[model samples]
Target: MPRVSFVHPKGESQEVEAAEGSTAMRAALLGGISGITADCGGEASCATCHVYVAEPWIERVGAPGPDEDDMLDFAECERRPSSRLSCQIKITDELDGLVLTLPESQ
Candidate 1:
């Protein structure tokens, strides 16, 4: 399992152990982390699972794929260079200790 950290908009945080090959959104939801909605069920068609990869983890998470990038434009919250859909991020051993920050709104 890989440990992942999620920082709430208000500055609260939680660390969770996630299985390899699972999506970030799923891990968040399972751990009761509210930031990621995963409304489209990780299909890449919905923008509800929006999140920001923490600055240091940005490059490690990499940029969203073309389809995901397109959906991000419609995200309810403001997007940034680090904006990404949690459903699109897969957890791996290499991602152990990955950190993600939640936007105030979805």
Candidate 2:
């Protein structure tokens, strides 16, 4: 399992173990972490799963694809260089200690 950490805009952090192949949004929702709604499930159509990959993990996470990038334009909060849709981030051994910061709105 990979350990994913969700940091709220308020500075709160919650770490949870995510099963392999699961998306970060799924892990957050199932683990009851705040700030990730995942309204469109794990589909790439929604931007509600927006999160910012923390430093050190940014390069490892890579950049979002075309569809993800398009959907991000509709995110409830402002997009940043590190903005990403959690549904597109699949859990893997390489992401063991991935850290994400949730936006203030969603």
Candidate 3:
């Protein structure tokens, strides 16, 4: 299993262990992380699962795909270079200690 830490805007964070093939959004939802709404259920159609890949982990997490990038434009919070829809991030050993910061809103 790989673990991911989701940090809230105010700095509270929840760390969850995700199955290797699952998405970060799934892990967050199951772990009761508060900021990731994942309204489209992993479909790249919504931005409710938006998160900022921490600066140190940004390269490892990579950039969002074209579809995900487009969806991110509608995110409740402003998008940044680190912005990514959690549903697009697959859990893997390489991302075991990944840190994602949540926006003020969804």
Most accurate candidate by lDDT:
2
**lDDT of candidate model 1 versus the reference:** 0.90
Residue 40, model 2: Cα distance from true site in angstroms: 0.6
TM-score of each: 0.95, 0.96, 0.97
Pitting candidate 1 against candidate 2, the one with the higher TM-score is 2
lDDT of 1 by residue, 4-60 (tens): 899999999999888899988889989999867787788988788898898888988
lDDT of each: 0.90, 0.92, 0.91
| Separate clash counts for every candidate | 0, 0, 0
Across 46-95, the per-residue lDDT of candidate 3 in tens digits comes to 89999999999999988888888889888879999999999999998999
Q: Lowest summed-lDDT stretch of 10 residues in model 1?
A: 33-42
Candidate 2 lDDT, 18-81, residue by residue in tens: 9999889999998999788888887888798999999899998999999999999988899999
| CA shift of 93, model 1, Å | 0.7
Runs with alpha carbons beyond 4 Å of true place in candidate 2:
none
Enumerate residue pairs that collide in model 1.
Answer: none
Q: Which stretches of candidate 3 lie over 4 Å from their true place?
A: none
